[model samples]
Target: MSSSVTPATLDYLAQRLDELAAQFPTSPDAVDLVTLTDDIGTLGHHLQHAIERAQERFTAPETVYPPERVALVRLARAAAGIARALDTLAEALTYATTGFQREAVEDLAHSPLRNDPEVLRIMTAEKYVAARARLRHTAAALRTASTPAGSSTPRTTGLQTQPAAGPQPRQPNRH
Candidate 1:
């Protein structure tokens, strides 16, 4: 894509992830499951927007169909992926938990009546953290695999190159 992810967008995503993480153990008890459900939905919405922006800004012009139309199609596919992930997670949580708490999350995740920006913001953060953690873990595993057994990463030395000598001339001084 021609347009890279902007700093502002990264910051926005980070802020949202932080908010979502903060609500974890406490928020679950406070409002039941609405927070989690809303967050997941928000994540889906944000991904949809992101995919649209990416295709519009990054894709080459010679791609057959119109830019906006192509972006929309890609956006829909991305949104569908997010929705499926949310549905699976929601179903698992519902099946695994009991009482008002489970009900709350289930309702929020599946709710057709409400859509809150705050909740979505938090959910977006949740997804970011989860994805980042996965990336870090994968990186660590790869590093470990690539490293030689019992060998530490090699250190760098600060040395400059010297020019090779070809010939030297001698000078005589007269008294």
Candidate 2:
């Protein structure tokens, strides 16, 4: 299975895993763990799409006569592992959240950003608006980079890319 898997596919899978690992908190609370679950889910979704794309490419009639069934099986197993891991993490988060005080949990749910005044300020600033536009542009470039060669359009994932409805009213500097 390892032999049949392409280097590019493995690299992308490893990169995605690295991203997930980087998001892991050393001493995570219920909220952090829940956020990790969401990140893991997104990674799993992207990995599934990548595996499907690879399978389609390898199984195409124009290429090799015999398909690599072992590689496909390995990919499928990896995807299942991802799903199981997410489920387990969610269960753990549920337990953690249950152990916390109801009011604390409610606070986490209602206003996670309330503790970080700088984040709130930055989020409303004109600079953040410009940075968000730049981020969107960069995300578009990354989508292009991940696209398979010879494909006309970039592959779509669960991520959405909607334009802002109107200009944001920038808050005055509060230093």
Predicted model with the maximum lDDT: 2
Off by over 4 Å in 2: 1-5, 29-34, 54-67, 98-175
* Model 2: lDDT of residue 40: 44
* Candidate 1 Cα errors over 4 Å, as ranges: 1-4, 26-31, 59-88, 96-175
TM-score of 2: 0.41
lDDT of candidate 2 at residue 31, scale 0 to 100: 28
Give the Å shift of residue 160 in candidate 2.
Answer: 19
- TM-score per prediction, in order, is 0.35, 0.41
Residue-wise C-alpha lDDT for candidate 1, range 1-175, written one tens digit per residue:
2433332333343344344334333221233344445545554555555555555544554432343333334434444544554554455244323322334355655554234434533443444345434323332332232212343322223211111221122112101
Clashes per model (N, Cα, C within 3 A): 5, 0
**Residue pairs that clash (backbone atoms under 3 angstroms), model 2:** none
Count clashing pairs, candidate 2.
Answer: 0
